[model samples]
Target: GGLVHYVTWPGSSRLLVSDPAALKHILLTNQRNFPRPRQQMSLLRKVVGANSLLATEGDTHRAARQRLNPHFRFANVSLVFPIFVETAHRLVDRWSKLIDADAAGGGAAIIDVHPELSHFTLDVIGLSGFGYDFDALASAGNPVTDAVNSLLTPLSLFVLLRSAIPALNALPLASLRKEKEARATVRGTVAKIVRKRMEQASEPVEK
Candidate 1:
């Protein structure tokens, strides 16, 4: 218990780990001994696909990581470096516009940077990962952005109760219905992007 301690919740207890060596042992050296909690996996799979690396375990996770490793290599990552720079400039311009509008109204602008940063992150991921432009910084009403935001909404008491009692998840609550729709929107959008890429790959290249 040198760097680990137990913490109890309403219905369960879990270890709070802090030691770096112990963490490495649990996460990398002997990962098989520990598995992600079912509740955590279920929540992640709802957003990221069942087969995604984050939702899978053991050999499946390893294989998924290997498949994605090439895309994270130095050369491949550098290919998307321009996207990062361009997105950053867009963020700056957006902030500048806000500041200018505030000044025009004769008041100092107090900006909430969290949502802006979130938009920047989404923009980068959409462009670099999927070759899709979320344009989250330019506008807030994009369907893809709306879907992603819905998934990020803060958990309510109903959601907490559902997690504690899995049976409640089957109830016909409006929040649950909205969450299901959001999941569908995210899944469908990603599938369309993937299908387009597959079709492009199958096309004959000009000599």
Candidate 2:
């Protein structure tokens, strides 16, 4: 909504807009006239290797947004609040027990509560955000969420590498093998949950 200057990477060329309305006119009102600047899209395309919502342009983005909007809507979120409350309470209770254990043993316990909090948040968000229960706060995280979290460190590197030396990843190698294995673990876990839900949905309703 304000003036913006576009700077070229290897060269020196400046593009500018002075009027606020004109800036909006180009960026939002008529965006197709200027696609994602090469600098940003190039990095995105290199990373995910698919035109996901963040990377999608024009009509594809509009369509995807329309489809996914309901999942993020307020009304849909209301249905999952009980799950969120229960999971949060369970997390508090678990932490209380850990503290209790340390007190009883007369020794200070060193524990990173970060992972515990993360799993709780994931369970809550999964249920509320997507109408799916990840149950990541259980004895252990639900398989799908656990696998995904386990792979996050490696996946972050994968994204970084893709953005940095994308073409080199095309070769079959040890790194690729580890990436594939991690991806497979995540996929299998998610597929199991989806299949179970589908089977349940297909069952005949009792009168």
Candidate 3:
């Protein structure tokens, strides 16, 4: 088997695995030995947590998966069908209203659905999965949405350079400072939601 190399810089070369069997062997059969590159993980850990399931590997990843398996089983998912249907009906209602308003204006109405779809996705996750109302669909300019979107703003030259040379992230650059603030806001918002849910859980249920 021959190797495939991608030249990134004058002295840097990144290897690419072209063979499917080799890819699977490295990624699945022997995953622990083929952990994500440090640079990629570092960027991701800033958005998610250091111990977040997506960022974890090896024993930590296996343990996290084991702990989370039950709630994702088919039997458990079937129980949440009603929540999914309710969220879907709300989405239809919102779009219907938009269409109706546009019809009243007497022009072929053009609607951009991408942002609304993102809101719907977030709202579904909040209501169906977490029993919380993010209100991302009902509210315009949600802070959480803004914070998460800002986190993924197309990589600027500054970001690309900093990613290539991680030491640059340590410097006080304006974009880097903004990225930190955005991540903090997302983390803080999620913590508040989790604390509220825990408090609700502790309350005694009424008959």
Candidate 4:
């Protein structure tokens, strides 16, 4: 697909497309000519915090890609379709109830869509990615939800800063303290889930 050039500040570089043909020319046609740009690496380091598919390049990236590819196979994804459908149906049912309630109130009741949409998206992630229903969409006062809502503003600014500086991220293991703490919280939660899944998989299945 073709990409439109984004008009932005003078010093900032415009977005790079990396279209299939462009990707092929850089990757296979001139395999040894490619390297991960420093600018890209700096942005990836903030969230992932180390050598990730975004941060690494060459054989290291290729090897990691191969290793992770199995997790996304068509057969594996097919197994999870039912879980996704159930979550979607739950969302629809919720909206239907709100509509009914509004009708009872003679169309005078105001329904808030913003918070419900956010919870719906987050719950979808929990269901599809982690194979657990977060139930954030069910009602008000979901305790774990405030943690996610608080990060939105800072996360956007951090991503922008990462793309702009591209060198400050290269300073080995140092970052703005608040950003670092946010990154730690997100990554730590992911790590805990990984450990839990690994342990569960290792245990014998109970009949």
Where does candidate 3 have its weakest 10-residue lDDT segment?
152-161
Judged by whole-model lDDT over C-alpha atoms, candidate 4 comes out at 0.69
* Decoy 3 TM-score against native: 0.74
Measured by TM-score, how close is model 1 to the native structure? 0.84
Best by lDDT: 1
What digit string (tens of lDDT, one per residue) describes model 4 on residues 168-189?
5555553455555666676777
Who wins the TM-score comparison?
A: 1
List ranges where model 4 is wrong by over 4 Å.
11-40, 93-122, 136-178, 205-207
For candidate 2, write residues 1-207 as lDDT tens digits: 455667764476776787878878877799889787564575554333446677888999889888999877788767777887888898888878888899899987666776777788777866664456766766564556555555444335455555567686687888666656666775565567678778988999999
TM-scores, in order shown? Answer: 0.84, 0.58, 0.74, 0.61
- Which one wins by lDDT: 2 or 3? 3
lDDT of 3 by residue, 1-207 (tens): 546887874578888887889989987799988889786787788788899988888999889989999998999888778877887788889888888888999856566677667777777777766687888767777788877778866556666667679889899778778888899988898888889899999999999
Lowest-scoring 10 consecutive residues by lDDT in candidate 1?
A: 2-11
Better of 1 and 3 by lDDT: 1
lDDT per residue as tens, model 1, 1-207: 546556555556677787888899998889999998776777778778888887999999888889999989999999889999999999999999999999999999998897778889989988998898878889857877777888876666666666668899888888788888888987898889899989998999999
Alpha-carbon lDDT, every model: 0.84, 0.69, 0.81, 0.69
Clashing pairs in 3: none
Candidate 1 Cα errors over 4 Å, as ranges:
1-23, 106-108
